[model samples]
Every structure is written in C-alpha cells, then in structure tokens.
Target: MKSERERQLMEQAYAEIEKYQDLVHRDPYRLRYHLMPPVGLMNDPNGLIDWNGTYHVFYQWMPFRTGHGAKFWGHYTSPDLVHWQAEPIALAPSEWYDQNGCYSGSAIDDDGKLVLFYTGNVKDDQGNRQTYQCMAVSEDGIHFTKKGVVINLPDGYTAHFRDPKVWRKDGLWYMIIGAQSKSGDGKAVLFRSSDLCHWEHLGPIAGGNSKWLGPFGYMWECPDLFPLDGQDVLIVCPQGLQPDGMRYQNVYQSGYFVGRLDYGRAEFVHGPFEELDRGFEFYAPQTMLDRNGRRILIGWMGVPDQNEDRQPTVGHRWVHALTLPRELRLVDGKLRQTPVKELKQLRKQQVAYPNAVVANELRSWPGVEGDAIELRLDRIQLLGSMMEIHFRHAARLIYNSDEGVLTLERKSFVNGLTETRQCRLPRLRSLHVFLDTSSIELFVNDGEETFTARFFPYPDDRTMFFGAHGHLQMDIEKWEL
Candidate 1:
C-alpha cells in the first residue's frame, strides 16, 4: 500500500508542477529536444529500463525549488526516443524507509511485472544518514506497490551505501551497489538473492585500496555493471578525485572499467578507469538494452555542486536537463557513443554545403547556423595549423593539430570568463555537433571522443564562424531539429 505520507508528498509535487510548469516553459533557454524537469532541480538518471516496447526513464527531481532536497522519482515514457511523454510521479519519499529521498536504482522485467530496485535515503535530527535497499512492483508499469526494505545496512559499511544495480545471471539474481567502506574508501560490492526479497552479501567486488587500485576516492556513486560484446563493463562516479591535469577536473567523475567478473569469486578484474565525457557537465549516466539489441545510455547534463546557483534557467524556476540518448558500443576495447539513430527522426529542413573550403581567414557558411541544429562535418582535414568553430560567440571548438589536442571553451556562467576542457588526440577528422538552445554536445571523429556542455547564449546570436589558420576542407550538413 502507498503510505499516506507518500501520497501527500506526491500531491505536493504535482501542485508544484501545476503551479510553475508554464512559467518554467516560458524560459527561452528551455531545451528543444531533451528531457527536463517540470519546475525544479533534477539530477541523476535513475531506474532506466525498456519494457514491452516502451522505454521508461526515471530521474531524481526536487520539485519545490531549483535546489537539491528530498528527491522524488519523476517519470517519462517514450514510444520512440525522439518523443517523450511525462508520466505520473513514480516513487515518493513517504514511507519510513524512504522518507528522506528515493535515490538511484535499476529496473528489470520479472514474471510479467516491472520490478524497480532503488536506494531509500534517510536522515535523523542530528543529520545522521541512513540508507535502505528497497523494491517496488507494478503490473501495468504505471501504478506501483512498494515492497519496503529488502536489505538493511550491511556490516562494515556506512549509510553511504546506495544506488543498487541489479541483473539476473545464471538463474540467480545479482546486484552491484555503489558504496564507501568504513575506512572511507570507495567500493562497488556484490550481493545475491534467490528471490527478490532476501539478499546475501558477497563482499566487495572492486574498489579502492583493493588489488592494484590504491586510495581511489572517498565515495563511489551510481555504479552499473553489464556485459558488452565479450567483456564486462563497470561504470561509476567517484568523488574526491583531485585534478590530474585535464582529468578528474569536475567535482566528480563518471567513467568505466572493462574486465571480467568472476561470479564464483565475486571479483572484477578490470582495467584503468577512463573518463566517459570530457566536458563540464555529465554525471550519473544509466544504460538500458533496447529492443534493437543496442545499449542506449543517457546522463544528467548537469553535475552536482557545479555552478547550480548561476544557471540562468533557475530564475524561471527549473534547472538542469538530460543529455541526448546515445548508443554505447565497445570498439577496440574503448567505449564509443553516438546519438541514437532514432534522433534522426527529429531532423527537418536538411541543408548541406559540399566541400566547404576556408583558407587563412574566418567566415560563415550561407545556411549553416541555428540555435537548435545538427551539424555534421565529413572528411574534415586540417589543412592549416589550427581550426576553430565558434557558435554564437558563446562556445568555441578549437583543434590544434600541431599539439594534437582538441579543446572546448565556453563562456563561464558565473564569472563571464572563458573556461576550457582539453583532451589529447593524435589527429583531427570529422565532427558531429548537436547545438541545442542552451547546450552543445560535440562528438568528434565518429564518437572517438565526446564533449557535452551547457551554455546560455543570446537567443538572437545564431551565427557560426569557422576559422582556419591556413586551409581547411570538409563537407557540412545542417538540419534544424
């Protein structure tokens, strides 16, 4: 039964939505083709699953305001990824187990019912934190029945344990949870269950101060474990990583490890963690296998504790959004992400400039710019020492072929200064860019590397400038999306 408190919280959230949704929608910086909250702050993509030909996406939402607080699970359903419909709120923090918040988790289809396993967050008067691994079931995938707590605090761990990612393997159910050890080291542990209720601890599978990893981070949040191709991939967000040049530059980092998971030993022998995105925004990504046998992943377009108060959309009563759904693949032992093909359905008014050439000067193409557009540059060649593309004078993509480095610079929302993110690449090739009203996603060299950022440019400044120090050649295509 849904608790009365849960029902009351849900009603309050709906009231917030009904009161401020229109006001939020009037913001010019609102996204054109992405999932955003109705009227408040949103973080972490949670409970991602594809069930019965419909895709369900749940996210962490703070409905009363544009700041993080007691979170509710906001729901959205999509027949095709290009179109999304907002569903009723999924889970609320009404029950005692989850009175504080309903945090991140995963979903699975079991016995013709949709099963959701998520973390219940709680805090006491002295601000002591408590956590529980809880479950819920829905026959129609709409209304849900909470199953309360299934797993309590395990021995030798703090209340920081949360974000359960579960899967079925070899006729048994297995789960990997993001946690922090009692010693304050980050960990991803394993557990097993015959039924969905009772769980048996299987010890830490992979974490800091274990095996080759030493003193990695203070906490690990939002861990996902799955098999791709012939190897297992573990994706996690680790906090307390100091900056190592261009890496670990954000407050937290989300990356992955590819290795083998030994079920009997409950150990994961993996490789070094590689940053999933090299941009200012992107955290707590979740993936689900679609009907096409593709691994589709989406991430929160904003990071925690990163210029949240400075966001322009917050004044309108909503903040943060989700990145485009990208299909994940393992190519040459590294992850490759490209916008899912279904997004092409949003393409309209195709415009192409074949062999657009520039030399020793900056210029603009006749019809190659818009605030919301899909720009594709094919067979790109850096005939000069450098090539730069400036969008609306707010963000710039610069490639320094001499240094073999690509850099993204955007005007800071807080200080009005130019901020840059750089990653070393051997050479330059093609560029696929998605320019939304207030964001840009750069997929370079056929998803070889990707950069996602949120920028607030003047609505009228849709001009794009291409500069080549010496010479450049490429075929460009623009589609208003």
Candidate 2:
C-alpha cells in the first residue's frame, strides 16, 4: 500500500513530467553502464548500506523534472553489486518538516531493522533554508516509516548541515555530517549519539588546518569516515575549490585523506588532500563496512554543477547512476580501489586474447558492438604517449603515459560538450576498461587506480577505435556487460 506522502509525491512528479514532456531533455553526465536512471536528475547516493542480506542503495531522486525538486528517496537493492533491482520510492517530502525535500543521508541496522537517517529540508515564505535531521525505519527493507526530526540544527551551524553518515564504535554511535564553517568554509562535523535521536556535537574533524587542507570551499557534503588497513580514511565531497591545473575541474568533487581519529580529543589529524576517484563525474560518495569487515564505497555519478537539462536521455526519461562499489584499502599511505570481486557474477563469456596485436594505425574489432563490453589489455605498449581508444563514436579515451594522464573526451553530443580528466600514473602497462553503451569504468593497472564515468551517445554512433601515434602492441578482450 502506498503511503499518503508517496502518493502525493508521485502525483506531483507525474504532473511535472506531463508539464515538461514536450521539451528536449538533456543527456546525463555519467558514462554508460553506471547505474543511471532511465530519466530525471540524480545526485548524492544515500542509504548505501547492507541490510537483511541485501545491498540497499538509495539516492537523491527527482523523478518528474530534470533538476532537483521535491526530492524523494529512490530505492534499489542487489544481492550482489552487479545486478540491481529497482524498488519503489522509499521516502517522500510530504510532511511539513521535510516538505521542501528529503535531502542526503545514510543508513544503519538497528538490531535487525533497517534505519535510515536523512535531512528534512524546509523553506519559509521568504525562501530561506531550514534543515532538520530526521529518521525513518524499515522492516521489509522496502517501505519506510517517517520518524520526525531527531536532531535539529544547533546554533553556530548554518543551514548547510546535511548528509549524516552514522556508524558504531565501542558500542557508541557516531555520525559525520557535511556542513559549512561560520566563516563560510566547507567543513564536516562529527556527532556522538547513544540512541540515534539526541546528538552531541564532537566539533570538526579535518577541515580546520588550512595549510594541509587548503581552502576546501565553504561546505563539505557527504563525508564518510572508515578504518582502512590500520589507517582511518576520510572521504569528503567539497564545493568551492579553485581548479589547480588538472584538479578540481568538476564544479564539485570527492577526495580523501589518510588520517588518525582522536576520539578522546574530539579531533582528527590527517595528511594532505587526495582525490578518491580521478574521473570526470564522481561525487557525494558514501561508505559502509560490510559483514566481512571490508570498507566498500559507492558514489553518485553526477555533479550538481553540471546541468542535465541538455542531455538527450532526459527526453527518454532518466539521468544518473551509481558507480560500481569499490573495496577500498589503504596501502603504504595510498588508497587502492578495486571493483568488488562479487561483480564477477556479471561476467558471462570470458573472451581472452593472449597474443599481443601490434597496430600501426587505428583498428577495429568484431563482436564489440553491444551496449556492454569489457576490454582487458595486458602489457599495452603505447609507442607514443598520444593514443586513444574510441568507443561508440564521438567518445575517445586517451592514455598519455609520458604525461601520466588518462582522458575521456565526448564530443558531437550534448551540443558538442567536451570534458577531460587526468591523474598521475608514472607508466601504464595493463589496462582494464569496461564500456557500457552509456557508461565507462576504467581500471588502470589492475585497479591500482580506477576512473569511472557516464556518457550518452546516439544509437548510430556505436563504433570502437584503437588509435596510436606509433606502433603499439596490446592484448585485448571484450566482454558483454
């Protein structure tokens, strides 16, 4: 049975769809194969926790329009991370407290029940922002019950207090919420809650030291902290950072720092800032510890700075997706990301090409036309640093070993929009690149690093290309996603 709030939000969403049905929708910014909606605008991934033997993923969903409005918690579950089952709307902004929207938050297991803690966004007559931290409980792992505001915005904190992520340590509950400093700097606040209702501020964790942290914008959204291999890692998506050469190109981005948490002192000390994923579109990432004690992370594939109204898929009906969950490990002071091994279930026929194929010019491969294909290149020799692997036309991903760069360029779509992102990798040998019709996941050097992105292309542009400035030899294998 649908709740009154759910029904109202559905009606409003449908009405908005009808109102904007005629307009040309924009293409989603995420790459193909990532878990994007068939249509609509998507943002921060929320409620990304394993409960009741199923992995539940909820996101900031705006169904009827192409932008953020009257947000609802869209639900999807997967026995494994590869195959996801889309469920109904979980939470709606039907109540007065959260009428404006139900913003981003996280999930936890209270005993055996699934508990969701989220932000209740409200606006007054003058359109001022009033945010409240609310709670909800789910029994069947599908439907949710709204439990009114559990924690209100304390004094000295601005309306930016949102995206609460909770965890248990030493039988005490701890939460990290993204917020802005009184000086208008982006920060994340830690709170201690014994019962999930009353929260006591633990003060700032890692955003105060400007020398090491830089001026990290005004607010850090979706802050996730976890223990990775004897080190505590803090992942934060901060806004208002100036682009330093190739870094922080996206309007907002996600990154992390290896640090130590001094719970007694109510402070966290960390090293310099480093990006979580060096990709074109990854933001508002959330992390949780599974039963196996592994810290798995997932992120929203779209950024708030990019406009999705111009994407072609909006005309068809969906916008963003979640990046494949990655197992994060801190190795020698560096964070290593590898796609969860459980994703192997998604691999059907394993096509192996052992012999190195040397090509002086561009070449094509047969049987690689499907919307999903996994390419594994063993010992790829990029004779010239300037080379590209083209997929589905208009989209070319280049790897420049000399410059330690990997770039994915998409043109001829979205009114000819082009974007490039690069990370420092001394030399590239083995490359595992996953290509879905609308998404791309690049695992460089056996997941020592990864770059996940989403893109949209016309149906006729489905072609693959391997271009080299000089002679190149690579062992390639393509798999159906």
Candidate 3:
C-alpha cells in the first residue's frame, strides 16, 4: 500500500515534469538515442534486468533540480534495448528508512515477479549517515511495492556501504556491495540468501587489505558481480584512485576484475583490477544477461565531481544521460564491449567509403557529417605515427604509434581549455565511433578499448576531419542513428 505522502510526492513530481517538458526538450543538446531524465539530474544506472521480454533500467534521479538531493528511482522500459520508454517511477523515498534517498542497486526475476535490490540512504540531523539494503516487488515491472530494509549495514564498514548487486548462482542468491571499511579503505562485501527477503552476510570477498589486491581506493561506490564465459567478473567504481599514467584520471574510476569466486569460502581469486573503460565519462556500469543469453552493460555517460555546472544541458533542467547499451564479452581474458547489436535497428541513411589513402593533413568527409550518426573506419593500415579524427572542432581522438597510445582531447567544460585522456594500445585495428547529440563514444580495436565522453559543440558544427601524419589505409561506413 502506498502512503499519502508518497502519493502526494508523485502528483507533485508529475506536475513538475509536465511544467519542464517543453523547456527541457527545447535544449539542442538533448539526446536522440540515449536514456535521460525528463527533468533534473540522473546518475548511476541501477536495477537493470531483462524480464518477460522487456528490458528494464533504473537510475538515481533528482527530479527537482540539476543537483544531488533526495533521490528517487527513475525508470525506463523497452521491449528491446534499442527503443525505450520512460516508465512511471518505480521506487520512492517516502518511508522512514528511505526518506533521504533510494540509491543505486540491481534487479532480478524472482520466480515470475520483478524484484529490485537497492540501498536506502538516510542522514540524521547530526550528519551521521545510515544505509540499508532494501527491496521492492513489482508484478507488472512498473510500480514497485517497497519491502523496507532487508539488510542493515553490517559490521566493519562505514555508512558508505551501498549499491547492492544481487544475482542467483547454484540455487542460492548472492549480493555484492560497494563499501568503505571503517579504517577508510574501499571494499566489496558479499552476502547470500535463499529467499530474496532474508540475506546472510558472507564477509568481504574482495578489496580492503586483501593479499592479492593491494590498497586500491578509499571507497568503492558500486560493485557488480557476474559470470562471463565461465569466469566471474566484478565491476566496481572506486573513489580516490590517483592518476596512474594514462588511467584513473577522473575523480573516480569504474573498472572490473576477471577472476574465480570460491562459493564455499566466499573469496574471489582474481587478476589485477583493470579499468573497464579507458575514458573520462564512464562509471557505475551495470550488466544483465538478456533473453538471447548475451551479457549487456550500460553506464552513466558523465563523471561525478567534474564539470557539473559547465554542462550545457543543465540550463535546460537536465544533466546527464546513459551510454548506448553495449554487449559484454570475455575475449582473450579481457572484457570486450561493443554497442549492442539491436542498435543497428536505429541505423538509416547508410554511407560507405572504399579503402582510402590518407596523408599528413586532416580531411573532412562530405557524407559523414552529422550530430547523430555512426561511423566505422575499418581495415586500417597504420603507416603514420599519429592518426587523428577531429570531432566537430571541439574534441579529437588521436592515435600515436610511437607510444602506442590512444588519446581523446576536448575543451574542458570548466575552463574552456584543451585537455586530454589517453590509454595505451598494442596496435591499431579499427575505429568505431558513435556520435549522439551531445555525447561521443569511441569503440577502438573492435571494443578492446573504449572512450566515452560528452562533448558539446555548436549545434551547426557537425563537420568531422580524418587526418594521418604519414599514410594509412582504412574503410569507412556511417549510418544516421
């Protein structure tokens, strides 16, 4: 049963949304193929699941402003991930335990019902924080009934424990949470449950003074554990990761660890933590296996603690959008992410270029200029030290053969000055670029490395230039998304 306060909040939220719809839609930076809040702010993709032939995704939303506050679980649903519709709010922070916010979490199919697991965040008047692993049930996958707190904050962790990702394996339900130890180190704690409502604390399976993994971060925000090709993968976002050469440049980092999880001992024997995206704007990624048995992931396309005010969309009363859904695969012991195959459904007005030779100067393509389109430069013969693709005069993706590094450069949203983020690659193979209205995602070498960022060029500036220092050969294909 819904309380009167929750009902009133919903009514007011709908009114605010209606009032801002036109203003928000008028923003030129509005995305054509990305999931964004109709109003206010969005972060951290949450409660991702495939249920009854529908793809459901939820996010942390602050509908009243383009900043953080008491959050609600905003939802979207689709028959396929390619096309989506904003659904009614799934979970609200109206109850006593969750009055402050309903933070990030995941979802699962409990028998036939859609069950969601998330963190309820509360801050008392004294500034002390409290967290609870909460659950909700949805018969129709739209409206969710709150089941209150299922698991309180366990011992040895601070209130930073949140973002519960629950999955079932071997006839038992398991959960992993992002946490900060009382001693101020990041950790991923484990739990088990036979029934969805009752959970058993299984201790810290990864992070926090582990012998195999050294001190990684001060606090881990979102941890997701799943299976990929017979091996377990743990995806997490850790805060306070200092810059390590070309990686960990952002305020926080989201990455994964490929390993084996010992069920009985509740331990994850894994390799070194690897950054999932070698980019500036990918975080809090969540994955779910689809009906076709493919593991797919989606991430928030903006970074936190960065240029919050400088985003042009904030003037229109919205902040961030989700990345295009990407399919995840374990290739050669590394996670390879490619845009989901269903996105081909959005392709239209195909254009192709035969194998082309490039010289020292950048050249623009006549048919490949658009704010929202897909471009593929394949079969590349890299005969140059540097290959550059200038995106709309605002951002550029540069490949340097000398250092074997791929760099993305863009004007800082804060200072309007040029900045760059880079990652090392062994060799160059192909470049797959997806350009939405205000964002760009570069999938390099068939998704071996990806760079995701939001770049706001002038609305009319759709020109892209391709340049090589010496000479390179590649084919190009593009489709308006």
lDDT of each: 0.92, 0.78, 0.90
| Tens digit per residue, CA lDDT, model 3, 1-481 | 6788787777777887999999999999999999999899999899899899999999999988998888899999999898899899877788888888999999999989999998999999998899999999988888888888999988899999999999998899999999999998899999999998789999888895786788889899889898899899999899988998887998899999999999899999999878988777888999999999999999998788887767889999999999999999999889999998888899999988878777888787678889999999999888878898888888999889999988999977778899999998879999899999889999999999999999889989989888999997889899988
Best by lDDT: 1
| lDDT (Cα, tens digit) per residue for candidate 2, span 167-244 | 899999999888887788888788998898888988887674353466678888889888888888888988888889
Deviation (Å) of 81 in candidate 1: 1.1
In candidate 1, how many Å is residue 242 off? Answer: 0.6
Sorted on lDDT, best first, the list reads 1, 3, 2
Give lDDT tens digits, candidate 1, residues 246-311.
Answer: 898888999999999999999999999999999999999999988998998999999999989899
Compare candidates 2 and 3 on TM-score and give the better one: 3
- Against the true structure, candidate 3 reaches a TM-score of 0.99
Q: Which scores higher on lDDT, 2 or 3?
A: 3
Q: Which pairs of residues have clashing backbones in candidate 1?
A: none
Ranking by TM-score: 1, 3, 2
Which 10-residue span in candidate 3 carries the lowest summed lDDT?
Answer: 1-10
How high is each candidate's TM-score? 0.99, 0.92, 0.99
